[model samples]
Target: MHMLSRPSVLRFDWRPTIRTLPEGQFVAAIGDVHGHDHLLAAMHDAIRRELDELGPRSAAVIHLGDLIDRGPRNREALVRARAGIDGASAITLRGNHEDRLLAYLGGSPAALGPWLDAGGEGMFTQMGLDPWRISPGEFRARFGEDLARWLEATPVMHRIGQLVFVHAGIDPALPLDRQDPHTLMWTRRAWIDSPGPYPEGVAVIHGHIPRRTVDFRDRHRIDLDSGVVNWGILSGLVFHGDRMRLLQVS
Candidate 1:
């Protein structure tokens, strides 16, 4: 596997909001995986190599969610994400796609239609079931129950010091504590278009909208969804004290 690395330099304008992690703490935040288990594996290997060179440190590997659907190995990706990298704590967030699955599993039969439309039918196909043919009760007995438990366990947001990690961007108008869970997992243009100072010294790390590359141009937000399902690239942002780096595996 080939890997790409680059120094992540925050611009002066972003200085007011972005803060450093605690001394000797390191965090590797991965973007939306979308069932690319091979890319996820390669990324873990790359992060392990990076950490080896960094010496002893407290570390965490945060997956920015969308761990299932749209690809062939949804269950494999979810399992690997839960296991995380060997030397770091694993933290997983909930994306809108996972929310859809959870809704259907929670008894909203209508949710399955939209979920299937959003590439979830592929997940059922990979599981050797036809999404169109399976009834909700049958699906739950086969796979939904376990998957719902996993998705339910995932938090919508995670915070370590001033770094806030969410599947999608948060509501800029509200304080972190006041944010709606829905906005944390689903907001798009409203969150993206807002020119936010982001509640003072708080920087948001998120993945929802897919892009050709990680979006690091923003002052206080980092968009790491590199369209892995389609583009064949997966990205992660590494945070060490105040310094950051971009890592990508393709």
Candidate 2:
């Protein structure tokens, strides 16, 4: 297991933090995969080993989303994440990338502009499709039918105990149930630069904006995106009994 201390860039605050999970229960939250299937596969194995070392217990795997686009093995990465540990043990949130792809397939031509530049080129290339000529209707008919359904079905946010897992940050100003889905899958500055934890006091675990490394600085939010497709490492956070462990792979 790779250990990461809190990032030094975090601002000073005096709020109390939860250092561990309840006994016999463990949660591992993975970072943005982009399209690196190898890194994700390694992470899966690492989590399995860690769970084994800890002995028998209830465990949950949470994927921070951004499972597609911007990398060399887009399709494979999506398959790996969707297959997950026994399929039922992991919860995958919906990221903005998935949202954009769904929109493009759902007939919003404008959505394709940003989606393509953000990694759609590589994704389409990997799938052997002509990104320039694939019509939204044809894309959906030929290849997007199942993909659209899966992406559309993904939840924008997932919560367990005191941890709220999301593809992106939440608006700390609103109640958890009242949080806008758009904000849950896209907001950045508002939640990251908040004065403190959410008013509800739950810590958020999210991935969207890429960071050079995992972030565990703020007492309220944990960022796991390590820019894996851009030569940075993929990161994961393991929570058990009040304390947490960091896992990463380049």
Best by TM-score: 1
TM-score of 2: 0.87
Instruction: Please provide, for model 2 over 139-202, each residue's C-alpha lDDT reduced to its tens digit, 9 standing for 90 to 100.
Output: 7776657766876788999887888999988887788899899998889887667746675678
Which stretch of 10 consecutive residues in model 2 shows the poorest summed lDDT?
Answer: 6-15
**Which parts of model 2 have CA positions greater than 4 angstroms off?**
1-19
TM-scores, each model vs. reference: 0.88, 0.87
Q: Positional deviation of 17 in candidate 2, in angstroms?
A: 7.8
lDDT (tens digit, per residue) of candidate 1 on 1-250: 4444442322112122246888789898999888878778888887887789785479999999898889878878888888888788999899998888888777677888899888788678778998767777778778756655876789999999989999999888888899899999999999878867797558899999889966666768888898987787788888887778788877
Best by lDDT: 1
How many residue pairs collide in each prediction? 0, 7
Error of 2 at 145 (Å): 2.9
